[model samples]
Target: MSTEQVEVLVVGAGQAGVAMSEHLGTAGVPHLVLERDRIAERWRTGRWDSLVANGPAWHDRFPNMEFGEVDPDGFAAKDQVADYFADYAQKISAPIRCGVAVTSVRRNSGRPGFTIETSEGTVEARFVVAATGPFQIPVIPPIVPDSAGLTQIHSSSYRNSAQLPEGGVLVVGAGSSGVQIADELRASGRDVYLSVGPHDRPPRSYRGRDFCWWLGVLGLWDLETPPAGAEHVTIAVSGAHGGRTVDFRELAAAGITLVGRTAGHRDGVLTFETDLAANIAAGDASYLALLREADEYVDRNGLDLPAEPEAHLLGPDPACVTDPLVELDLAAAGVTSIVWATGFTTDYGWLQVDAFDEHGRPAHRRGVSTEPGVYFVGLPWLSRRGSSFIWGVWHDAKHIADHIVTQRGYLAYRAPRPPQ
Candidate 1:
């Protein structure tokens, strides 16, 4: 393989990777970004055609550049998001090596950096910022067997409601993706069965403002995340479907059968627990707790704003509280498709360094790894609740860039001179 060297090697070209590059460039750090495909691969390939960002465009801008004349209240399409990242890369002149896939990474035992093996060449980087991106590994049930006639697809691979076989769709998760897809299929006149899980179901807009506004105003964004109980619970926000809250109550009301956690599948019989009500209650409890905290904050600050927020937060729809479907016979019930929106995982096995814990997760401090110059970007719970979001990545990228520059003595650095 050929050889290349850079002061920093960024392992992705998504929003996070582009943001990292931009920040590093602003800090005058010499770096090159390596992308397996091209910029915005996830936006182009990972999402469905109708998928819109769960957050509005205004909240997802690049550092120092507010969304240019775009509707702040409107959620962006996948292509729109991809365009934003592309624009950011061009505006900052981010040095990207597209079509270069990082096969493996190892510490240069003799040097203070890393040796990253890629598709095109070997890169020796003083600092390796892994922004490999999310939805890395789709988590599916270990027990799913190959049924002769049924078609199954994980949410990661699912493009739309029309991709699956014509029959009832068993959507195995009640998070944003699952509900959105379920609603899509339901709207298409397909019978949808939603496997309920614990989730937070705050309204999309509360008190004449987006719920995100309340989160910002209440300092929930400041939360050091993987926030105790919220580590596993998904925030069920649906920007597609008119930016409304994807409440389980509404789903149940629409004739979607809400079942409990999938116990397993055996002999054409799919088993689910009787804990659907419990899961819904758990989410409502958390939702109420969040509202209580926000209420206290507003009261203490004398911010006498909207009175409707209390109503929105306190009111629980009776439809959401429901009995669980204990089990369903897949063959008899005519459930021909199963979509697992079970979430994602990552594999750091390619990294030769000991950057992982017993659980095989990257060990890092606010994007900075304990393993010297090796860092991570776009990791959930990296520093704040927003770390995985576009807004949160900015903070983490800024910190990572600052640390790399300050520690490696790059602050007084200058941009490379143009070719004569």
Candidate 2:
């Protein structure tokens, strides 16, 4: 019923949205940011208590503000990161209206703008930035069948190991989240089984230096000018799992049993591949080789490093063997929980725009959508390796903000608002 007008409307006030808002403010762009809940609620409520940033603190900051100079190697605790975002919002005085959930975002047919229908009211804007991150939706494998007896929870719902039922707990998905949760559960005295998948694995540190330092020195994180003929190449970096390469060898040393990808779960029986260990080991070696190549390139470039990258001697590698299919009797193992560390999914059902591809991702070229005046930010691989990382969003945000300013005069054509 109530209507407001603005030059720009930014949806979601998390890292991406906030970054965009900061850039717009710096450029004196008039914009309104709408957040469904308080900023950084995902980090405050969705993450576990013991979770620390997987990357160094330097990589965890937003645009101009850094997370501080201390604890560069150690990852920031979740609360610390959340507080940083809160402080950032206050520092910039971002024009954010919290507690307003956007129900729909449709192009105003006659106004050349978008009408964002929210729980509180409706707002119209000439340009819309879908900064709503990709993690809002969780992807639970359909292969996981429903069983009245076994309890299953996604990584988003999991807070700690205490929530699991008493028995051998099976954690599905061996990504960073899955691996970390499995490690915690096993350490908590629960017999844990981990389902491995196709994931990037790296050591938290190689030798004694943090892995990120090498990444930065090697220009792995500095792909602002991508090489010729490699425009579509996406450099892999760590994300929510912590930017640090996960050390699979460390996981094995910790006595965690690795299993194959989860096939299905029925009647309290979970089926997985028997060659999981071999697959995981092979995957680990491949990732290590990539890092080695990166290190070599850095050295060849004669880049002076503050610290020497350590060569990780993983030791005489164990003979690869097929993962034995082993089912843990929950009752016997006292494992009462199942945490699906499987990654996230993207859902844009509320967006009434034809800018997305078949996979539901916004069709964009470096943040500019096919639909004029529509833009996207905070997506994985939006531009380069660090695009979606906490510190990486700023680069894409600045570019998008610049584009919006340069093209502002051309967006005068207005579309008609749909009949209310």
TM-score of each: 0.92, 0.86
Candidate 1 clash pair list = none
TM-score between model 1 and native: 0.92
* Candidate 1 lDDT over residue span 77-116, tens digit each: 8888888888878988999889988899898876567888
lDDT of 1 at 420: 100
Q: Write the per-residue lDDT of candidate 2 for residues 1-420, one digit (tens) a residue.
A: 669999999998888888999999999999999998989788898888777776778656764777863365557878888788878988999998899998998998865788889898888988899898878788778864555356788988888878776667788877667877887887887777777766555555554456566566566776654446544322222333444555555565666666677786555566676656665666666567756766676567765544334543454333222435655445555545677777777778888898898887789988899988889999877877777688788888999999999888556558899999
Candidate No. with top TM-score: 1
Candidates' C-alpha lDDT: 0.81, 0.74
Superposing all C-alpha atoms, what RMSD in Å does each candidate have to the true structure?
Answer: 4.7, 5.5
The number of residue pairs in model 2 that clash at the backbone is: 19
- Residue 318 CA error for candidate 2 (Å)? 6.4
